[model samples]
Target: MRRILALLLLAALGALAVWLYPLARPLARYGALPKGLDRPLNLLVLGVSPEYSGYHKRAPERFRGLTDTLLLVRLDPGANRVVVVSIPRDVWVNLPGHGWHKINAANPLGGPELSVRAVEALTGVRVDGYVMVSLEALRRAVDALGGVRLCVERPMHYTDRAAGLRIDLEPGCQRLDGAQAEAYLRFRKDALGDIGRIQRQQAFFQALKEQILSPWGLLRLPQAVAQAEPYVRTDLDRETIGRVLGFALKRPALVSLLLPGRFGNGWAVDQALWEEARRVYFEGQEVAPASSLGRVVAVVYGPGEEERAQEAARRLRAMGFRVLFRPVDQTPGRTEVLENGPGLLARDLAEALGVPYRVSGEAVLGADLTLRLGGDGRGL
Candidate 1:
């Protein structure tokens, strides 16, 4: 009896295959997806903000449920890895019948069923199931866990008199429970912007995953999981849960991909950015990397500055720009855009991957990085 109790405890914490191992067994089987089982299972997790209803229920003036928070969680039983990719709800995607629309709009038009269908239709990868959550539901769950610890690299703030949400904070670590976390998750107005918001969500999720794996976090598992269910709805079954648990324990390789490249500045909003976003979070996995013709640029920045460069590169690449360059330190001397490499290292690439031209420029931190296109440059 003592051993059994100990095992249960272990399983709860998401620790090694101790007491908690069997908890997911039943659900794992129920969840084993039928169609998209060839590749690892993909589960779509959508978060709908507070809903508004009226006479326009059927043909909603807006969406039934606005799925602003999007997460694509990939579970590989064979490889023992779990990967969750996040997508901005504002991202633009081409709707089958509606021309072009925001990715989150697919939810209200179809509900879980249509949302799943549209996501699968858009991304190419089969969506085994989906989990939907409402605003209050997630807020309660985060509160139940007594909030979570999150580290802020920089200060962030948002003001919504209508929604009655206001956010202001300085850099460093902080713990946000239900109300605070909910506010942070919903607000998108900040210097960092939506991309930065997604990054915060990702970091929060990653940290939560780490904490849950520990015995301490697992001790609160049942309560947390239970609190989540009311706010969360999913098509996943019993067996699927087990598979994920088992795989999560065995495969640390499970990665979280924001996407191939970036689309726009956090503050700059546009449909093209959304269009590229849809291509990445949804359609990217379905298409082969080779067949998906696009470019990847590496924008390198120094300490305290890499984030911008990294994001710029991601956006440019996602936009199908083949102009992938590394972010390097400014060369000592006059600054100018040249078909030159990092302190002359680019000379080899300039010769090898000959392009029409190369350009370079400079910018202050927290601003934009300068660029220069070459008239006739070569490099690999």
Candidate 2:
């Protein structure tokens, strides 16, 4: 019902605003958020189900339906680190006012206002903005981009009879259309269950982000904007939206991240760990120090460059990289800045560090100073 009203309001506003587009500058300015915020800015992202299919179709009569997908986007402009913290929608959390409940319940309690409060209470970081996307909106946008080419990390399998969603996982890498991508987002019950789905969501969002920032995607921006205007709800106003879109147009390397915190058995979000997440994110603290944690920082290079490789490790170490497990690989994955959430933060520091890791578990055997970032302990 609320979503319906919002959508109707959107349509009416769009119709009127198309004429009032000239007035949009002032109207738009009113809703603008403060730009130039510090990096790792927390953004609450919720994947909501479609409110209404069409005029003739009746709406589903459920308010407590599963939001299922939850992700906290940490945007750090200063350090250029984009950290995303993924929380299992089903993972129960210690909610304020009410006894423990699923974190998604924060929405029902209060829309963005309450959800922001709840997440802030949980992680102690101020949410810069909220992007409430209807499940359909994302699908539409994905389709508009001519269906994103998704890289499947692993086979995903799940069936939700109640939700009317089904997924079958195929191992290795694969591409998925918009519908398939939505299924990918909906699928859980892999080895990690809800947790696994969270990881996929990160990858999916990354792929979407990449696609949207692509040249062709930019050309199709008009359609994507149309799709989002009616269904997507966010506190960010048009100008802010335009500015961010411009950023995408210019600097499209927005990083994607999943908090490196591994939930224990049952996957319940612990109260204490919630605070830990807060510290890592809000305070720019490193959860795992480079000196102690086992990470292999391999300065990737071609064959017959062992001496140069070792020299690279020493160079990185001199620059304060842990360089724990050095490996000399002729071929390596493209360089990616992956962080293990706030857990890999160094105490007394303001930002979480992005340390290199062992490439797909391969060890480096030759090089001047092999850049291998591996192991299980913290470094000095």
Candidate 3:
């Protein structure tokens, strides 16, 4: 509901090509960002599923559904990049009053506040702001936007009567209604499970971006905003919305990442992987000191550079830095150092490899840096 309102209002404002700060003043007051805040901001966005009016009632034990979607969106005006990190619902973490449990429990335990705290504890990142949208709000928001087009990768068939979720989708490119979209995002019955679902959500986001920014979407903004106003909830005001929307509309560089982790006994993130994830996606700096050569976790080379990667890894190990050799999806034109966090280590390694260094969107999880051995590395 709140998201629907925010989207509609922001779209309307964007289309008008004018700032009605006075009119939006009231709405902005509710959840407005503090004035003159200019820095990288982290927003903990929770797609909540609280039981709302007109929604199907559930059993007492299952009445309060956990947060359906957990996303940390990092908006860096300086770099002009939007880094979106998805946290799987099942990732176990410590709860405030309760013992360690699945991270999603934070929402139902104490709403968004506790959820925010839990995330802060998990990621060691300060959340500047947050937005909680109910499932109903998300559904209506999608409908208000006239549905989003997506390419369903494979046939999806799932039914959970207890949860009142029924997903039956075919493989193809098509537009999805509000209900279908919700089901598509909620389905996690495949082999990859939640990880695969996260991938689909990322894809859905791309499609949603296209739909909301389209000309027709702009035209319908006023009506959508008007209809969604009552259901929306946020601490961000109109001015902040405008600013973020402006940057978002520019289609800045995007880094889509999942909190690096794996599930065995249960979903858990390795300490090293979490640290690297924070360094690259949140703090944007190295947590360990520069002299800690063991801090350098790296992937070695692209395709056809196996021998080079092996050789480089051998050298890096001798330098006391930990290195992981792996193949990349594509080969690079030249040798380059892909920095996941601060470029200090990457630059040093690049100097060693005699190649230039650059920030990378495709950062390897648990890696502090990636050495892409290109044709230039043939000499090394």
Candidate 4:
């Protein structure tokens, strides 16, 4: 009886170790939790589209295309907020070793590593990890989910004989199969061009979010993850991935935003606007004493100070201010900050911009706080 009990105890210990390995192994090995996994994280997600000739046939590696989509996903578990910022593929940026080129080219040149470096340089944000998904993987994942239902706003029809691609989508609410869904996402030949396609993509994801948040969808997550694992590549460890997946299952609302830029020959970044968007969406309100009040701010600058105003706006926006630039007719001799009433936001703005401010006068109607740029704008 004693011998049997000892053997059973040993077997139980083995089972316990197996169960605890995933959680405790990293701590034991590194003496710390995985870097940036448990706290706020910025993950770069790329969607790669490889060209194929034969129907439903996986092509060779030589024919793989550029990164079709680039997204910066910021996860703040403490605040339970997830912000996804989409970067347009056509945006022109300087590649580190290479000269000027479209952002999408970074992927094909050196794969995900180069892509990460290029985006980090362009946005001035550190990427904690990255996930790359091929088209085949997306197709399989969508199919595994038993198809997603979405409302098509208009008729979409396109065909490219060279690539053997076809997109025929009628306007209505209906269930889209894998192939049809792919076509819907890949369509871009319209008046709005890539912008229109992005809108549709956003809509599709919203519908997908609803489907995934359902009870039935939750049950199928493991199966979906297993089926799509082979095609998806990522630098994140299994533990971190598991944490992200668990958090996503909670169905916390997602905030989707576009990188603020102008589309010329390629998308040009408006430094001021882009920084503002980043602060309000990416950087949470934790800096100022009363940071929540800086959700939306307006800036009015004097003549001969457009550049200064833009710079000031950029800095303020990056520090969690929703800065809006509005030029005024009257010019000031020096920089001045104004607010409607007693609030911590004005003081925070003044300190951030290194300018003196007052607590009276109508700065900008409907704006929480206002900044006026003067001729001798210091620290702009």
* Local distance difference test, candidate 3: 0.69
Per-residue CA lDDT of model 2 for 1-380, tens digit only, reads 99999999999998765644533443344434434443344678777654444543425523233455566776656555555666656655666677777777777665666667766765666788887777677777777668876655455667765556668756433557667878888776655566666656766766676676778876665566565555556787655555554333335244343333345644545456456555754566655544533334434443354565566456556655555433332222233233333423222121223333311111222211233222223221
lDDT of 3 by residue, 1-380 (tens): 99999999999888565533323633444433434336777899887665534344543323245886889889987777778878888888878788888888887787778888998998888887787766665577678778888767677899876567789998666789888998888888987787778867876775776777798776555455544555545666566775675666556666666676667755676668568767765665645537736766565455566777777877878878888776644454456677544456777777876777765433454567776666543455
TM-score of each: 0.58, 0.62, 0.64, 0.64
Candidate 4, residue 238: Cα displacement in angstroms equals 2.5
RMSD of 1: 11.4
* Candidate 1 structure quality by residue, lDDT tens digits, 1-380: 99999989977686644433443543343444333233467888887766534332222222257787777776665545555656666666666666667777887666777667766665556888887877666666666566677655455676665556677765555777777777666555754456656756765665566666666666665456556655566666656655555555553543454533345532223335335434533343332223213422334333344454455455445645444444333311221223111112223223333422222111111212223221122111
Q: Model 2's lDDT to the true fold?
A: 0.54
What ordering of candidates by lDDT runs from best to worst? 4, 3, 2, 1
Candidate that beats the other on TM-score, 1 or 4, i.e. the better one: 4
**Residue 168 lDDT (model 4):** 93
Model 2 segments more than 4 A misplaced = 1-41, 50-65, 250-252, 260-281, 284-289, 292-338, 342-380
Locate the minimum summed-lDDT window of 10 residues in model 2.
358-367
Count of backbone collisions in candidate 3: 8
In candidate 4, which residue pairs clash? none
| Alpha-carbon deviation at 85 in model 4, angstroms | 0.8
Please identify model 3 stretches exceeding 4 Å from their true place.
Answer: 1-37, 50-64, 224-229, 237-246, 285-380
What digit string (tens of lDDT, one per residue) describes model 4 on residues 118-185? 89988878998998887776676677778788766567899887667789987656788778888988
The lDDT of each candidate is 0.52, 0.54, 0.69, 0.70
